[model samples]
Target: MRLPIPTLALIASILSVVTAKSSTGDRVLVVLESGIEKGDYSKFWKSLEARGYSLTFKSPKDDTAELIKYGERKYDHLIMYAPGQKTFSPALSPQSILHAQLDGLNTLYLLSPSLSPLNRDTFREYDLEFTDSSAGNTLISPFSSLASDPSSPLIFPAHSPLLSSSPANPVLSPSTLSGGPIVFPEAISHFAGETPYGFPILGAPRGSYVGGSGGNSNSTAGEGRKGGEVVLAGKMAGVVSAFQTRDNVRIGFVGSGKALSDKVWEASVEDQEGVTHRTANAAFAQDLTSWVFQETGVLRVECATHWSKTGGEVEKAEYRKNEEVAYSVSITQYSPSSGTYIPLVTPPSDLQLEFTMLDPFVRTPLILNSTASSAQGSTTYSASFRAPDRHGVFKFVVEYWRPGYTYLRSSTTTAVVPLRHDEHKRFITGAYPFYGATVSVSVAFVLFCGMWLGMGEERGRKKAE
Candidate 1:
């Protein structure tokens, strides 16, 4: 007998739910303020769901709030939407969270002015800071596409990436429908040699300000927050920033709690001309989350090796000054579509190799390796150069850093020495004059000695007679 339409529909729905539940990808932990029911933010959760994330939500005060289990992280990422949360479970202390990131836990965060000490410490460990609101915790800008009052919540026309280093900005239509700047000029210590990687990727328009007054006013704005003076806004300020650890773990932050809130996320606006367009919040959410979860701009160094140029074979520390040598490295990056870190066969032109002792002795481009020079079909970058004529401990150093991509660093040291006595050439073309002069002097001395001895013997014979 054929199944009824209702029964078939029910079965299909059950299967779809099971499939979603069983999906395998980055496991996400979401901490939110209580009293805000989960269903209220269905759109935001669904946005992440469409990106292959398995989400788990909890209150900071959840009795069983846990992140790590037995030295292993239980979740791959954290989304904190609770700005006023007074406390967090002990497992989320700065030290534990820092360690989790060291072991690779990406994060997405939004902070409020009422920062708890625990949350503050967490941000500090990652070399990041949220902008302070001097006027009030909230921002109201005169440059509005939505509200007419300058002191009311402002809507920004998001265009152009914060920096050329940022990924290309998404295209928007209707021209007048713009994006809003999330409050705060967050500062990120993006330079290397600090805690994980951190930098700004999105920016707010100039002249935006913090509204409301009579609270803590000791906060300084960060990079990209400019325009409104008196401390809250400056010349240039960033609204969104990102970071990543050496382990390829990542973190993203948006200053406004409502940046993706249900109310403003679906922005539809009309002007006097009656044309309508959506705001950039949706595009920004996709881009930011993808980056936070390692879906965008992720790279890895698989392995590196160096070998003597004579036979192209690798062994322990053995090299000679002025000898030819070759160096190669394999690289790959995350491909969201394939769900793998695929080989980066064609890298940028600036990719290079540094043969260094103290300063660089050889700096040259690393080109794609020939199939014979590398593992067959490997995505390897290779280069060859003669070792410096001088001898000391040298290294095969590859440091490839570019904007919007993970930094790549690899250094391998090798011992180098002058040629051995036997290995020295009997004659050098460039030293022919010196060798000729020395040989000529030696032969003349021997001839002079022979002449002197003969003269002495003749003189003695004459005196005896």
Candidate 2:
């Protein structure tokens, strides 16, 4: 029997809602200066809605509203969009925001400098610092012929491969959208961060610093700055900065609020030749949102297990050195483009696995196992190796790190031991020659003992005679 058309349509609508709810569970908290539709940031909110996010709004002054409560996160992501405000609601204190991030909330922060503004103590904890004084620098590049001026450092080669690239460099676009390099006219210049926490992911071009109160960073290590980053050091500053918390939660810094505004994000300008193109801002916004919200670059270790090949024991936590062990794990990546978690990534991103102790005893590349399912959204990679002759505790570890993806790490340990004395067989087929030689020596010794006893008895009889 076929279903009626009306009934089918109703079913489809319900299914669609269910799918959206399940694909991405990103509950977003957008703290702004005012109401959503009442503000000039309607377009920014629209871009997020397009990505299937459920959003809640809180004004900078709405301290009574809780961003989180009762040790349970009310939201999965947070966007601090009110840059010009002098202060925020009590709920948005540095401690509260940091705790939310620790609870796995990815946050995007937009900052601007003004005298006597609210202190950004939250950013400082993440190592993002801003001086009280303003900058005389422009984030422009002098080398690019496309630079309409010396200040817009976001200029890329007109024919640069990034323009037509897919996935938009994570800050550029989701995989489903096309993206080019991003540029903003009014970027706030700041000093760079150091290793791990302070690594600069984006930069201004060379020959581009106009020092003022926040003068040329004494950090001019490379690209004209001292004690600063080598590759990230450009003329005056780094435009967009990002870092991942130990929980794999991401945090990104956008230099200006105007850069995310509707006009700038979608603006297309004409050059001297009348060639027109849109700013990469729109795609950048989408991509950055996806990344910070855990919609993109997410990795999960669904399964990790090992078993002895000879014993066929997956449950055994101990094994003998002679046994060959099979190690495998099921890993999946959250695809923001498709809005679902999948095992394999397009263009074949690599996943690395290590078998180790103090050092890697068996280091080998993992091959994608036969067990992969598109429906289930998981990929299995596996390897087999003989247990080392040395006896001790050993572990299987997998660490997968990519520029745009969340870091993935997991481990499982097992004990390897030598065979007990009683476990050894009395005789062995492989040592037949040694066994036979031992038997022959023992028989000869018995015969020799019997002959010596007879000789002793005969000597005693002769003495009595």
Which candidate achieves the best TM-score against the true structure? 2
Residue-by-residue lDDT tens digits, candidate 1, 1-465: 999999999887655433332112479988887745677667888877865577988887775656778877888888877666666677765566677777877778865555565665567666755444444444444454343333323334344343444333211222322443332222211111234366655444455544333333333433223322334452334455666666556777666655576655656544224445455566566666766776666677788988887865865476888888888788776666555666663456568999999999999999876573345334688898998988899888998655456678899999889888899888789999998999999999999999999999999999998
What are the runs in model 1 whose C-alpha is more than 4 Å off? Answer: 1-25, 148-162, 166-196, 211-229, 271-275, 312-317, 368-379, 431-465
Candidate 2 local lDDT, residue 368:
79
Task: State how far residue 34 of model 2 sits from its true place (Å).
Answer: 7.4
**TM-score of each prediction:** 0.73, 0.75
Candidate 1 TM-score, C-alpha based: 0.73
Among these predictions, the greatest lDDT belongs to: 2
lDDT at 402 for candidate 1?
52
lDDT by residue for model 2 (401-430), tens? 655555678799988889888877787899
What is the lDDT, from 0 to 100, of the residue 257 in candidate 2?
57
Each candidate's lDDT (Cα)? Answer: 0.62, 0.63
lDDT of 2: 0.63
